[model samples]
Target: MNIEHLNVNGMELAVVSSDEIVIIDTQSALDLAMTVKYETNVANIVIDKNIICEDFFILSTGIAGEILQKFINYHVKVAVYGDYSHYTSKPLKDFIYEANHGKDFFFVATRDEAIQKLTETQ
Candidate 1:
């Protein structure tokens, strides 16, 4: 796993890439928030999609909502970067599209895009 801290848009963001699934549940989301805060003192993060559980992409499980809520409650703005074309659900696609338009959460296709989206508050 590699974690890097970046300064962008007047905020610091922790970018993490792990071979294993790092965020699988709400608890994992808390854990990651703590880790990133401790390491970089940043509430913003960009994580590789491969490090997140597949369940997060399945809206039926409600995993994504809960996990994202935890991030929000903890003041952690997150951007998940990867290929989202595999998900065929319209709701999920709409969710991602809307998230990308929001300030706190984003789903993007690349690390650079993740950084850009995560940092752009306006």
Candidate 2:
């Protein structure tokens, strides 16, 4: 895993890039936020969607909201970047659509888009 601190539009963010899959449950989500806050001292972060656990996309488990709520609660902004076209669930699609439009969390297609959206989100 490669963690890099970047300044997008003058705002600092910790971006994590990895080829290895990372499972992010509610606890891990909090841990991630804490790591960014303590290690990088950045409130915003971008993660490659490919590293996220597959279970995260399953809305029925309530994992998505549980994890995302932690990010919001901690005031840690985040952007998930990758292709979401493979997911056909309407609820998931709707969730992504809603999140993309909102400010707290975003689902984007690439790191550049994620950085741009995160910048706009602030």
Candidate 3:
């Protein structure tokens, strides 16, 4: 994985890029947050949605909730950026909508937007 660090609005942020799925489960999510924080001293992160498991989009799988909870518990703010237009599940859509309105988690269409959202205070 490649981590690019940025300072926005006096906030430290890490943008991670990888070819494979980085977060397959809740443990992995916590590990990612800890690793990023330790390496970059950043509590905020921006990751591509493709690096996350596909099951995370399926609300019934419970992967999204579990992994996101880990981020919250660890005080890590995460922004996932990608093309989400293909997903048709209503529950997932609603989940995304709700998350977009919150401070901790964000779902955006582009990396620039993700960075902008992370920098803004709710």
Candidate 4:
């Protein structure tokens, strides 16, 4: 869980990069907004997705929504990386689909895809 702070649009974006997973733990809407604002400039955040825990299923979804809402508010784009196949809940799956389809949020299976999606300019 290596975390680093980055400057994006004059806002601090915390970036956590690891061999197992890379999580950008946004402590507030401003943190999320900053991340989305410079999502494209940051690259190769996570090399693998196997480090993500199954327990993060619900928390991750909630965080994604929160981040997306902030991104929408600021008109920015961001990508979330993790595997959703382990989850058996139908509603959670629906939420994931909805977030992925939206411009502000993207749910991906691989780190590469995550970085690509995040970096893509909208």
RMSD of each: 1.2, 1.0, 1.0, 6.6
> What is the C-alpha lDDT profile of model 2 across 1-122, one tens digit per residue?
77899987789988988788764688877877787789899988999997788999999988899989888888988999999989999999999999988898999999999888888877
Candidate 2 local lDDT, residue 122:
76
User: How would you encode candidate 3's per-residue C-alpha lDDT over 1-122 as one tens digit per residue?
Assistant: 88899988788899998999998888888888888999999988999988999989999999999988888888888999999999999999999999999999999999999999988942
Q: Each prediction's Cα lDDT score?
A: 0.88, 0.87, 0.91, 0.52
TM-score, every prediction:
0.94, 0.95, 0.96, 0.53
Question: Which portions of model 2 miss their true places by more than 4 Å?
Answer: none
- For residues 1-122, write the lDDT of model 4, one tens digit per residue: 44454544444333444565333433443453445336534422322334343433565456645545655666555555666687788777888788777656667887557655555532
Q: How many residue pairs clash in each candidate?
A: 0, 0, 0, 1
Query: Higher lDDT: candidate 1 or 4?
Result: 1
User: Which sequence of candidate numbers ranks them by TM-score, best first?
Assistant: 3, 2, 1, 4
* Clash pairs, model 2 backbone: none
RMSD to the native, candidate 4?
Answer: 6.6
Q: Over all chains combined, what TM-score does candidate 3 have?
A: 0.96
Count residue pairs with overlapping backbones in model 3: 0
Winner of 2 and 3 under lDDT:
3
Give the lDDT ranking, best first: 3, 1, 2, 4
Q: Which stretches of candidate 4 lie over 4 Å from their true place?
A: 1-26, 32-56, 59-64, 119-121
Q: Pick by lDDT: which candidate is best?
A: 3
How does model 1 fare in lDDT? Answer: 0.88
Which is superior by lDDT, 1 or 2? 1
